[model samples]
Target: MKNTYITHALFMAMAASAFAVPSLAQETNAVADQADSGGLEEIVVSARRRNETVQDTPVAVTAISPSQLEASAALTIGDLQGAAPNVLITSAGTGAAAANISIRGIAFADIEKSFDPAVGVNIDGVYIGTSTGQMLDFFDIGSIEILRGPQGTLFGRNTIAGVVNIKRSRPTGEFGGKFEASYGSYDQMGLRGVLNVPVIKDVLAAKFFAFHNESDGYYKTVGTGQRRGGSNNENFGASFLFTPGDRFESLLTFDKQVQDFDPILGPLSRTGDAFAGALPAEFVDGNNTDNVYRVVAPSQQMVGTYSSPGVTNEMNLDLDVVKLTSVTAYRESDDQLRQDYSTTGLYFADRDQQYKQFSQELRASGKLFDGFDYVAGVYYFNSRYHIDQFTSVFFGAPTHQDTTGWSKSYAGFVDFNWEVMDKVRISGGGRYTYDKKKLQTAFTDPSNAGASFTGDKNSECWKKFTPKLGVDYRPNEDLMVYGSWSRGYRSGGFNGRGLTPFASALPYDPETVDAYEIGLKSEFFDRRLTLNLAAFYSDYQDIQQTTTVSVPGVALPQTIVSNAANAKIKGLEADFSAKPMDRLTVRGSVGYTDSKFKGFIVNQPVATGPTTSISRSFDFSAVDMIYAPKITASINAEYKLPLGPGDLKLNAGYRYLSRYDQQISADPALYPTALASAPTDIITVAQNDPRLRSDAQNLLDASVSYVFSLDNGLNYRLTGYVRNLLDDRGTNTSFVASNFPVYWGFATAREPRVFGVQLGVDF
Candidate 1:
């Protein structure tokens, strides 16, 4: 049945190709006119493994220039939500480490890759495999391109939801550089530099970029004595270009970047309820990092432990957590988690996941003949991580938790593209990848702690055959029509050791996807208007998913991973721009999605699905949260002005994100937990239970900037911005239940109103 569908899709595409000859000629002529008008500049894209015009490519894509990114201050993917509708990357917690990226409604609910993310995050063609890893910051980027829908055919590794292509600045033949520096509230400080140097005349040129940022923690650490919510980072890179005036050239580039982060402060019983008596007066929110737990009866607790004259506390809590984390276990009589207890809480424990990565990719591309173009490339990478995660209770009390293993992966992929015809195009590419990983406990045998089990659960496997194909036709001088079909996949790995026997990792299978898309790219109204639209349908098989639940008699929680569901995603995206005046331009986009489970049966002992009637995509019930209504849209208008000194440009914009849950959690019955005994009066929910669903909130953000140039060929820019302009508080809630409700808190309030200003100069 699937083969028949592919055949029909190809036949129709072939027919379209057959009739697009005249349109091709017309498009070429129209392109010539646009060149004269300076509106349709050549857009070089490698979506198919080779460079081509945006209109000549068959994929649905949106490209934002460096100026656009700077104007919006889109420092990360999540900030790109209102900047581009089809691309919605959001965060549940604080900082650049806890964001979830969703493309066309395909989001990765599991942060640990037991289940893969539909969309993949790539920086300079290097795959950022995990969901948390995707939360990294962006620096020294020349441009950003977001391809909506499935993208399996060309890129290797991920192509489930879509692709985010980040293109960094390369070496320039001319010697020049730009520098930006800023300081703001929260003791914020940042500096960045981009330099292009002429190394060997026209033969070799070199480019260098550097960034450093430091800030104080936003949330108080209280008695813990550790600062949380602050960002400490340092990044730098160098690229050497060797053109040597030949068809064969090589570009050698490398970068070293790290974010030394302060972990997010622990659970808040409620969102902004403000702690008075419920929280001890000596608790000293935000500055104390004492890990020793001490309970006080109203009579014995003293006032001002730090400032008071004579206050003898029972426990001194000598904490040295930057180096070690203490632990505590309680053998309670009842089930641990209860719905009524939290209302909705933030369980601040389980805080490990520090990432460090190194990657390399070498690509070469050139025009072949009168109607042919091609490209080929090799990729390699290595990453090591040392993480310390823990979940603890208030008053500096360490709860039952586990310190897990160090994780790692190594992989490679080869890709190529061919422009087979003048008017018609065909692209083919593939990748061979191998990934190995392990997870074990760092703590000794603790009678009442989860994740304290020993031995590494090691799994390693090879992934082969990831290919892509595409076709584009110019229906007329004004429109470029196209269609594409491709394949993409994510490597599989082991489940953490905390899971029960039957639910262990075992032999998990790699998940694969096939995507089909049709679209139009065009420019009209005499170079004043530009528009792009696309529709896509994708089929996913053996999709990976995970459920974290606790066993009744055990102190630790269980994590189950398997290929338990299949899914189908369908969506449409539109991008439009209008430049009415010479110095003024307006741009906006919208994305619509419809997705659901196709074939799913939870806890199946084997890989096969049971016989069942087929209906709409949403009929299958094994899915935890694939179906998402993520309606995102935005608009920005910039008007260039002529002020005193030189060319003065004024820019301002607004962005909005519709309500959508970050993850579709599993429900109790389908993915159930073992018997429970705890102290809380509430009921214990399963790990994957969707009922602990986090709330969805809308957000709005805006910014403005100005540019000024001097008489000596030098330029300067100043920008002021505000995030969460409306202060629309977004709630982030997660369900982390052990044998009981050991930890509880709501995700932090959405980022507050952040006001910032920057100054830059080019030399």
Candidate 2:
């Protein structure tokens, strides 16, 4: 029966592909099937601002196709991590404010206010300007390509770890459209559409894509007047493709995305909830049910309860991106997220960030000789109106807002790929990037010893010329090995959110890294097995370490930001997939990462009391920031069974993350805030200890889907899936403190298991 289903699926997939072998995917990869031994085309990508096959290219890149995404119902960046090994996507709390994304285990540390990330993100050749941590909102993207190592050669600034490129679908000269509506448990509803129209025969084409999704949150926000936590999204995009006999080609695109999410207030107990991750003894009956924040009156002592959430967040995130590509491009990007994040249920202590960016890139790329591909381009990125604000909590719970920071960058580069030999691929690239940042703003009230946050408003600039060398060896159609070396750097700036003048006045040095990598990309068993394996070592200088500062008089507990330090990282990554038989497919990936600071010296910012000596308050610089265990393993399988109406698919997947503290330097001497007014020597926490081990449990997700094809061009599918089948306790805790004697705070856990059912039909 399974064989029958496989036979039918192959026939139908081929038939649906116009009865053609879809050499499109194969042609793009440019490798012959192991069994066929015939040459195939290489995958084409815009990794270097030009189109070339991933196999033929001379850099380390991993690409995930649309079908692969569909198979897993990947809607967020976290889902893509499964396909792209070593890419970690986690959240600080939940919602649109702090989505932490790290590539190559470079992102296992806590985030600071307005601090940049090691990994940068780009969409359609335009760079995203800010890292507010929780801003992962996207839909209808065609593909995602991750450049493993430093992308400073072609992509500049903050590409120390790598880069993530999101390529959206464009218009085709055909009249076709797809619409799907799905309904799942907890009132989950998802609707997505894709439409294409031919505006002119061979001159122009128009395409539109849109998606809407909503779901009940996994945890119930107890005592909230409204539904505690849930998810909602709306996204739309339009694109135009123009071509005149291939001599002149152009693409214009516009995209907009918005999201709404209500995160769960707190975490579950050590033993997880009976039905998954829930706060037991909370929200039992309808009205007046006892919840976490329920309060009871003395007169009614039997059941006293208050309906106030311990933590809550409500936010609106909107992103607008427009791009015009001819021989050049004018790219505009605006990402705005207004969040009311809080720990006290009330909307009074929200933190907010505003990101506005615009960029222009002009380039000319094409094939010169039969085997030579070249490109030269100029780039400019400007980010303004990067606003950061705090709720009343900053001012002894006093609200404050400031907008004195923005960044601008200019760069130019030339890159080319040459097939020197059929078996050897070489790529040479260089980029000269110069950036400047000027901050001019004032805070209403700093911490206890500060009045106006202004003198720290200084300006600094940097210039770097990064070059890259890469080579790919393809001994045969089924195997390839690649090597690359490159340099990456991130600029320096001030932390404006600090309260004391000294805390905000600190100066930081530029962070830089030189990386070397060797990798093997191969396919075995006639297109049935695909493997990507790599090992790398990086030497980092002036690394940007996130540390906290204590403001005795200010309202908030602490402030986090970047400081200079030396570090090193070494790791290995492997992704494997095998279709041993025609009907079964198995894919898995494992990553081993070791990142640590070599000479990290923390800067203590808390001022000693008026009665204390200067050395006691400001003369401490200790080594902090340590090893990250790294993300370990993930596996997914899909099996087909012959069913009465059609075929039934049994899909199961599991992902494991190693145990390690999300943030290090948690001891009294290092992460000292929790020990208010204590000596810096008292802090003792490190990066790889048990107190901070957030070794997330293996999340097992499985789904069963049945599909039926109608006589017309219509298909229907019904799927039932369980996320976190074991109802594991996913943790999200971190230690944040200033000096040893001040304050150290921790956050809540992750969302619990969710059982859902999805029904969909496409015509």
Candidate 3:
């Protein structure tokens, strides 16, 4: 029974850390003299790979500094999602290389290249395995953390729903620099820059950064009205720091990012209202107008494209007692997807995608005796992905799609923390991973459509060992309490846009998790109120889903990939902050997930003409759990006004997300099709069948800033923002079927009101 419930959760977390370490050092010296008044300051984190003080780190992280991501204009990572509570960064169809990050409610929204993404997108500490160009745009940042649950023994591969580190800003020996600019509202524009140099001063130093942005495309295109999800992008980076002594250090880096524009394709409305004439008249409804971010009749699109580049080499050595690190990395991306699924321009699609990666890591952290504290690591990874596509329907027939994929991994990890006494603390970690994958295909043979189908190969391998156990108790000095048990995995490939051979030769397995967490971190009154709480429970196995069948005389609809399903997730999170006066500050967060689906089955394709057989069986175990979402909340308020040349901040925030659903049988008898030729005219309602769900949102954002301060040591800042601010168009991604063989359900909207202005400088 799951190893007796993981050995009774590691013997009740080692008997509650050996009887709570003798009453937490006498209740932490009687609450350390009633906290001595103070509020909100310490906020350091590494989520256990080092650094501490996130209220003494019990995990369930959510850092986000850099002046709170520049007063929430966030510029990427899906605008850092309402202060992270059940995190969900998305983009699935636009810039930042189509991001789709998720945490807590693990997700892997497809963009296919051999899918794998259950949350894990590191940067700086390297690790960005695929998801082609996994969104990037926050330059020179110095923090971003967001580790929710199941971090798999010090972050080992696909963290099963958590992990998003992203630290930047290094190399600063002396000399400095900074710059910024912006202008917004549809014609948006932006620029940012930074520099730091002092070669050989502190043994060597150099750093640089740059970014540029453009906008104009929020949707609009109904028969050539051009514009659809816009934002041209550019970025550049550099780093070089060599300490050369003093506990040895080194860092060498390089970066590049580029993005052309236009591409969000999701606008051919007509959802609900049972059948609405069963769609397909170029998607009914006045040929595209009922503006849900508009876009009707678009075809043969083309604009920027996309490209990404990266390189890194990091090293550290303080080997006195321990502490040695090394990291080597390389990354690459290239893409071009000119889509226009007949939103008018009459059917078009030209696609291409590519990615490459290499990674290496080695580490050894300090203090392994006395009070204990340690870390050990080893990892190596490799990646490659490819795809090509072509289509042009309009009057019919014209197709091609190709694929190539690869992956490799090896890992070993360790972590430990003792402090067996003095207010308790005990931890453990483990990792063993080993994975391999391969897939290849180049098509043109939908059963002889043009006769061509090379050896379509496939390969797979996986191994796992994930583990972690923890306990923390501080009883006083502002309180702290914790518990944890973790495990995570996600690896298994094949099915890069399948169409035959049982969908790309078949391969799918690795997808495991087992997490349990409990937490509490407090700092009442004296600390001016700071509260944190967490609760989690997870258990998923062999659940890598991705389906879209239909083969009876197919003309596209394969896209397989399966491991059936099995799930059970739970959650509860909370975070708070308050200042009440001292310039007023108040933050908030709340989350509650429940997810279901304990089993599922599938095998579809109902009826079609001439030589077409039938097979149907759908069981979605009462579906529900795609983008999890059972309730999410957020609130923020910042105030400060002593204006007249400096200090004048004002910000507002509010967020909520409740309803959710994106796939897994939105019903229609599991999507039939083939409307004509027998079997009772087989057609099962259209446009994202099963009732595309998703509604329940309340976003609102605002900002205002002013800093100014001069006298040689410069400082100046100005800001003004408003995102969404109540221009909710909701539905951020839905679908019934498209890109051939239609069904009429399409969606994608969110990002309506936006207004901006920013300027900065600091020396």
Candidate 4:
């Protein structure tokens, strides 16, 4: 069956290419005959530390233009999932500001500062140090680039999977501005505006941007009669450009973001009726029918609030033969989460965290000789992270934990490209990274208030050398094929959520990946059609896995972090686009990934007697990797109609993903709800728990827009759009734990149907 699926996918790709070639040829001929020549627009990107056309760059990347983002109404970073193949972005926990971004089936879901993200997120060449505040709300003009596979050489560390690069629009030395507003379902409202001023004409300029949006949630709390997942967010930023000379320029920017919202934690099933009176009657009943998109909660706890403020300064100097640049940045965030965990209103958890980061990078890029170009850089990063919070069940039996950590990283890298022959080029690069971190933790339980539950300070360091080598051969101006081998690395750290002293003292090791890929990029029929295909195989070592396990006598589950095992992942990805006619455009992509573990084992707590307990290991070598859907595909189409006074545009996109698991552990005991009998001393449920699995998903989005010219150098655009048009049930996060003698698991739901209308004017 697997072979059959692969064969079918390959056939589909070939068929699509075959069909596109003929259409493109016909269109080119017709255009030439009619003298109405207009080819596909070229996209410029900075994926490899240099500005180049997407088709000319030797990397697998997807660039989303500002116009496309506006048309799709991508309010946040998480809405970029279906835009690229083998990429998935989901919210972590219930906070809209926490993003779990995965590319090629690799992601780090642990919400700890010690652990760096596998996929790197950056803005204007400045890296975002933590994932807690990575889910930035979208606003203003600019572009977004998604780079697939490891980017360890040019992008530095923590890019083992890929990178998401966001570049904001800068002052263009023109006096112009724009304003936008939108209204949507559930009383949603959005407003955004930007202004640019020429302080000194060609010498200096200033730009300011701001955005605000809010919505009443779709789900309502049964008892409080209030919306459970409502959201409110706002952001503003300013930038100043100083061009003192013809060869030197500097840009300074400052921004602040604020988010206040409640997350939707839907319940699948409830048992024991422990808080029957505290929760809604229907929610307490295990037999009650489930509504995937709705919540039945009584607590309706306070909102989770997150705030971030940051500043960056970048300077560039152009010499006769080389360009020198420097980027310095600082960012800080405060996050507070207060929510009911059990959905039954039986247990509420609260957490507060503060984070600060500073980084600087110096780089130089230019040509060394004829047909030879190079880029080199040095980077320094430092960060301070703290967490202090208390958890209370039934508003009593409070448990408190206070922790703080600091990290420092330094790296130097150099990349060189040489044209060995007329149609072939060789590229090689390497980076040496040194990482160090120190942490201190304290835990206090009122039930055991008199006992000592703290750990001493701990520190660790790691050093690694990662390299990349590739060869690109261009047989013709319209076609290129490339192959490369690369090494990726990510440093490890302590688990911030560990409940026990022993667990807090133990830390995981750094992970490494060796990847090999071969790809082909081609353009046909006067560049009216473009197609790119890539196949990759990766070997992952010392994979860090996170899981929650019950202790023998502890009142709460402790988070355990360990080096799980080795794994192998192989995949194929294809992206294609064709402008069949001047008024119509078609785009599609398909991704297939197969990931499996080897010699995998997980630790579980077992009770040998009423007073004795021990840890046992379970083998799960055959288990599949979490969040790795075997098949994912998407298709998009857009058409435009020119009228006497205006232009009408219609757009639609559809995406599909296969079933996949949402957790790292594969313990058999985590599948069943309870023990088999009262006298049973040992119970093992089974692997591949159905409760932790998410069904396949299909999502459709469509939009329509009208645009026309107005008087006095003003233009207006109006658009209406719908997301999740089919209202498919989609799960984002899954949780499982042994809460006493019973094993229960819960899943979180994604957004439902959303329809809105937007209006904008440029003057």
Best by lDDT: 4
lDDT per residue, candidate 3, 1-763, as tens digits?
2322332343344333323443221111101111223566777778777998788888788787777668768787778765778777667763237777767777878777577778888888887875657678785777878888767766546478888888888877766566677888888887767666577888999877767777887777656776667767776767899887899988998877777776755554454323335334545443222354666545344554877878898889886899888889887888787765424444456787778888888988988688898898888888887878866544356668778888898888888889889999888878898898988886774345544566456788888888788889997889899998888888887878775666787888888888899899998877788889999988888898887654555455566778888888888999888886676777888988887776576555644443364654555666676777888888888777777866788888888888677665435533333332344342332223433566677888888989776544556788999887888775676655531223445566667788998987656
Candidates in order have lDDT scores of 0.51, 0.56, 0.71, 0.75
Clashes of each: 47, 55, 14, 0
For model 4, the stretches where C-alpha displacement exceeds 4 angstroms are 1-37, 223-225, 269-290, 450-452, 607-614, 667-688, 738-744
Please list all clashing residue pairs in model 4, or write none if there are none: none
How much RMSD separates candidate 4 from the native structure?
9.8
Candidate 1 per-residue lDDT over residues 125-228, each given as its tens digit: 55665555455456577667887765643443546677888767767766666667777656677777766668899888887666666676554444454434
TM-score ranking from best to worst? Answer: 4, 2, 1, 3
- Cα misplacement distance, residue 351 of candidate 3 (Å): 14
Winner by TM-score: 4
lDDT of 2: 0.56
Report the alpha-carbon TM-score of model 4 versus the true structure. 0.90
Q: Return the TM-score for each candidate structure.
A: 0.72, 0.78, 0.33, 0.90
